[model samples]
Target chain A: MIPLSDVTPSALNNVTTQFILLHMARANKEPGLGAATCLALVADETAAVHFQFWGSECDSFRPGDIIRLTNGIFSYSGNRNALVLRAGKRGRIEKVGEFTMNYVETPNISEIKWVPEGASGRYVPESVVSPYSRIFPPLR
Target chain B: MAENLLRPQPYLAENPLERTLRESFDTNRRILDPPFPLSIPTPEEYLCLTRAILYSILTEGRTRGIRLKYLHAIVVDGYASFTALTASVVDELFERLLDDAKEQIVWIAGEMVEVGAQGFGDLLVSLLRQVVGGDYGDGNMWLCFEEASLFLRKWSALLEEDGEGRSALCCGFYCFLRLLGDHCRTRWSGDERLSALRQLEIDFCTKMLKEQFSLCMNVGRDLIRMLQDLVHVPEFHEIWKDLVLNPGAFGCPLFSDISQIYRIRTPSRYFLLRLTPEMERQMRFLLTNLKLGGQKRHQAWFWNKFLGTNPERETLVIDLIRFVCCAHHPTKEVLHSDIIPRWAVIGWLLKCCRKNYVEANAKLALFYDWLFFDERVDKVMNIEPALLLMVCSLPQYVAITDSLLEFLLLLVDNYDVDRMALITRGVLTSFDVLTRSGVVPSSDALTSAEGISPPLKERLGALLLRKEDHSAEAHAID
Candidate 1:
């Protein structure tokens, strides 16, 4: 369990955190995976991130749901062309609560660019792309 | 197959309480019936049996009889933890409960009452809270009917036992009295079941007021507020006459005048009887967590989820108003922080009202405390928000300021003509304490607000300028 701000682009299914879903886009089908995927803006008290929901996860969550992600991966996906947070093959997400958790929309970690550090292959935030999600804007 | 206690939603983790009960039931499945083990189990096994029994009773409809028998056989702690766990299920999972599961919960509540289980009163109160005040949907109305029937059926069982039973009866009286105001005045009165439910509620409330007047008095002045709405009903009309014209008829010597009811501040818990736990949670979250400017989204969510889809829900605004004013008092840190104040949330709720009656009732709820405020007993917090709301809405939303001030004045003059002086004194003291405590800088802001109409200002000015005649006023009321 960690704050969303601590998550960096990673291939390993190790990021564990909780966030409230702020905004969600309509689900789209991925031909290769034969499953539906939805893009959503999720946040915690610390920071916001772009969360990708795969398969039934798309229909299982909605705006205002507080979700807990276990062993999630935060890395760039070529299809979305963005650094997104997701429950990869080895990870899972569950709806924990709703409407009570505090959240921030700014400092979207997914919008920040990341670069791999020397030989360690660990990624670090390189430069800012946007302070908030470009795909799903903040509520007025 | 047994039904799931709560409606299954995708990707949601299992609730630990349900898991405990389910696992226990699974572990004890073969032994749940007949030929009970002759051995007295350890404390841990006792708890496991209780959980298993509760789970079986809730989910296993066919074997409910046998499961209840098992529960009775292993009773310890006066069924305290068992009833409390049932209440948690009601409070937490009720909204998602399948229809059959809901029926089972109500049936078990009746069983709990029959035996006078230790915490059955609280279980009944929790069920009562789940019956939304203004909801007219079939499910909501069905709950209303079932709970009303249960209260009527279990009236004696509720009264025969200890203090918890009596207090739970008080809670029922408060809830049904308030609910009857809705049930009697709705479009669904044409429906037979709703009509039957209305009659049951009226029967229970009228019986409480007529046969058990002393217990009804324990609910305080809000009793009159709820009763006033039902004056059109013939039964309550007779009760009202006795309340006002013949106080002796109630048979309580101390409660001779209605002012006595007015003087005793309605305890905060009575206000909570009207709101669902889910609604209470969202309101508390908005007031305690969100900042003033950022509340729009949460308010939108609250509105859409609770108030948006139905016109009848507009009436819930009144309950929300009273709940916010009487029930949820913020701490100094939350109050001092950028967190939204109670008045702001109230102001938004006022604007949410789509119907005239709802708006008026909401305003009355907001100012009901001010009509009978006693600094000795009533916290200034209750009256503080109305004046602050009036002051804050000035200049730009001048109409809000004007209407609220006009309503306050109207209430002083006509809320109860016979008790005008009491109400006037209450209003004056409310404004006085609000300013004196620096909740607002001065009363001049309201009295001198340019947007306020002239005649209304004069009435307010006259009321403010009137000298204190404590002895004379007390004599007049007495």
Candidate 2:
């Protein structure tokens, strides 16, 4: 399995990684379809990214649950400009273990201020937003 | 549209962006890479930094020249918007970004056109979507309405002058209009919902004319075509005044070809969901913009002052015979049922609609014909024949001076004599009431009766009791 840090926004790379959920935001209802979604900062040893859980997935996963994302995607959500990492339509995720994986929170990949022009002429990070999400605070 | 998949990036390298950004920021930096890659910035800082970059462009792009390569690098980097910016800042930020983009198109000699598009195209659209979708400060409906009004005014100004034969800028402006339109169309909703913003924008835009914004010849054309999909303007020609009276403003004039004029289809009946509330408000806003009172102005100026009677009480009653009412727009059924309770009689009957009588944009006439004759009506909406009789029986249904009667005669001529007989039987169901109703003209008026078909006149004559038999006509009929 590759580290989350290796998954860049150059193209849609089929990602399969195991990460422990550090925190999860409340399941918010979306606008059009009103589907529920939960946002949480998930991490493995190398780096971290915000993982979004949709519908039943939002309720099934919780903080400290080690989960394996199979064929997940990293991309920007339409309408709302937030970049996200999720198990897209063709992807799947399931609980693999308990809170056993080592992780870090300071580099929530989603919190970086990505300039439009990055080092590789892709959306590279510019600065830290915060060590964690302001909307969904990390579980103390 | 899934724009990211098909789009091509600009040719600028990454190093120039870091350098140019440092200059724009006036800071010493080896590189401008994020402290952590792809991290979302604080909403406040993102807004601050974005505002600063816009300032540099609007200022520098105006005085010095466009930093084309620098701008290209920024767009190529790809925007990582992990959060939706609040509504409060969207309008301000969008105005600056669009204004700067507008200037970059004009003063930069077209080199920055792609930069303006690639950079702000998605970003500004996302921002505008946020603004239009969110509340204007305190959630005041009027404030929302006014903001929408102002936005329509602003976007309408984004015109490209093929003045110098600069196709690049024209094409870029066209893309912007297209992108903005895609985001704003087809969300049917009440005023309280975000979808109503699309309707408000549609209504506000219909009020602007191309003549006012001389540079908006291309942009205005795009806007109207965009609007044509939102609301059905039955009289598209009336708006343009035949292009003869108002020349050259249209890039593609409304109803250019005779066939195109006939090609009009109203926005699907999904529009009817909010029509009852929206229609009044839209009409008022449009009339008020023209410095006229709402329903009162039409009643006073045309009917009272000149027509020698009140038009408020008069209605150009459309007898939609067989039932072409939309399954989606069931509200018309409510209005139809209320015909007898609301008023004594829908005093003026507009003759049945015909194709040749009305101009090319005869969609209303066409709709009436399709409603009566179309086979689809039987499948969906079953219009009762009793309602037609009640409408025919209204006390003041026929008046000598009503201009609408002229069109009804033409309908019988166009369709067939039998159709008129059907309409006459429906209207004059009871022979006793037929004597008081002079729907059919006197025989002496025959010289002018060519417009009315013979079968229709004969049907009307059958309903009419002769003056000699008038005393016993009711008894004889019974």
Candidate 3:
């Protein structure tokens, strides 16, 4: 059992791990069973993840519930920035002891450093191909 | 110098009214911001101010002309900023001014007619701008149309006398007629007003036909045809048919001549909803004509005249077919039976099936098995029977040979028997071929499937013998 603190939303690869401290919940309708609720969770760190529980299971888990997941699948939802937990069979929910939870403050806007001229941004760097040294072709 | 000194300066008038008017007009040179502070000036005040300015202009007509230009500027600025002079007030001023200067208006119209085609066209456009810009309420706007139409009729009469761009002017005249006709159709009420408007429209259209036979001959033809098609509505059909067929007797074109006629048969919340069933039928007929095999000349003619360039007819056909296929209740039956051909309908459905790839692949497997295995249909179009059979056998192949055996087992346990059977067959067929060719290693397959589905305890008994046999076979081969 991995601790919730150690699992980053960005690095959540195991399908069968419990996720606590979910912040957002939205109600969506599945085709056959009218309305179901989806929960968007992020671990104490800043990385974001989404998990969906449908039909009878949706009624069992609320937004603040501490849920333990079993037998689920991780798939990319839209972009690579987030992963979705889909088709989970078993979820054991435990009541949170306290209503109040401490959250880390986001970094101050003024404190962030700008990149230097040659430094690359967050994406992985690729080697330049010979004829494609420049990112864009010159216009006529 | 003596002549300049002797020139009467109206600003020097001693009367208190004149003095105050001059002072306020001069001081108010700068643009006024609303709330304009001043009380709403009466029509008499406007008239008095206009007269004083005109009097000053006449005294020094040459140099004073330059100063009078500033009056125009001031009026424009005042109109823009003054909230007191509302639409009604502005409308009254225009009506009064036009009433006083009917002769001047006629003179301007005559000038336009004498100045040849381009000049006349420019003048007419300017007049239209002036009319639209005038603050006539929607009702009074129709009143202004009478004067405008009279002036246009007089101007159009000069077409034969002065040989010019008669065709272009005729087209412009036709547009003006349409605008006025639309206005009457929308705004006019009472039997008298309706009859008057209808008569005016008929007269203008007739004049246009007499002047240029092809200005919109087909439009009239279409209207006649539409009226004939509405034979189900006996009263309306008879009224329309009588008016259209006996043009000279009833003073209107035959309904057949009115192509693409949009009659406001019923009033709606926002607009008079235009119903043109005949026009829609004609368009569909034209589209079908273009789609017909061979007769490229007819298709080309239709495309050039009606369809315009690069018409997306193929996509349109596909959409129409899809619409029919997905329609509800009564509409579904009507579309399936009457609207599109069977071959075309099937083609469209196939296109949708291809676009929705996963659904298509699944359905295709089911359809192939159902058709061949159960002998459902005599023949399937476009796809070969042998390929269909091969695709259908995929799930069975996957079950025997794939290393992701646990996933398949889980699928069987979790899903209904029908779904499990379908997916299993698809996966098995693909895996069987791959296994036979030794494309996938037996060990890697087993490792990948582990822990993903079902408890090892539940499946361990059934797989023990096969696992041992595979391992022994591998050792023997190595």
DockQ of 1: 0.69
Each model's lDDT:
0.86, 0.39, 0.34
lDDT of 3 by residue, A46-133 (tens): 2223455555555554333345555445443444433355443443333332112222212211112222234533222132122210
Instruction: Write model 2 residue lDDT over B1-478, tens digit each, in one string.
Output: 1001011222111233223333434431211323322545455544344433433444445422333333334332233321122111232232323344433322332232222242333233222232221122223233334445433444423333223223222323332232224324223233254346445544444333333322324332223333333233332345445333444444454434222221232222212211222222322232222211112222222222212332211211221111122222234544444222111111211232222222211222222322232222122122222223223433333332112233433443453343444323222232222222342233323313444445655644543434334335424432
Better of 1 and 2 by DockQ: 1
DockQ value for model 2: 0.01
- lDDT winner, 2 or 3: 2
Give per-candidate clash totals.
0, 18, 28
Candidate 3 CAPRI assessment class:
incorrect
Query: Which residues of candidate 1, in runs, are more than 4 Å off?
Result: A30-34, A78-80, B1-3, B469-478
- The prediction achieving the highest DockQ against the true structure is 1
Residues B214-298, model 1: lDDT tens digits: 8888898899888998999998998898888999988776778888998878889888888888889989999999988876767
lDDT measured at residue B424 in model 3 versus the true structure, 0 to 100: 37
Distance from true location, Cα of B225 in model 1, Å: 1.0
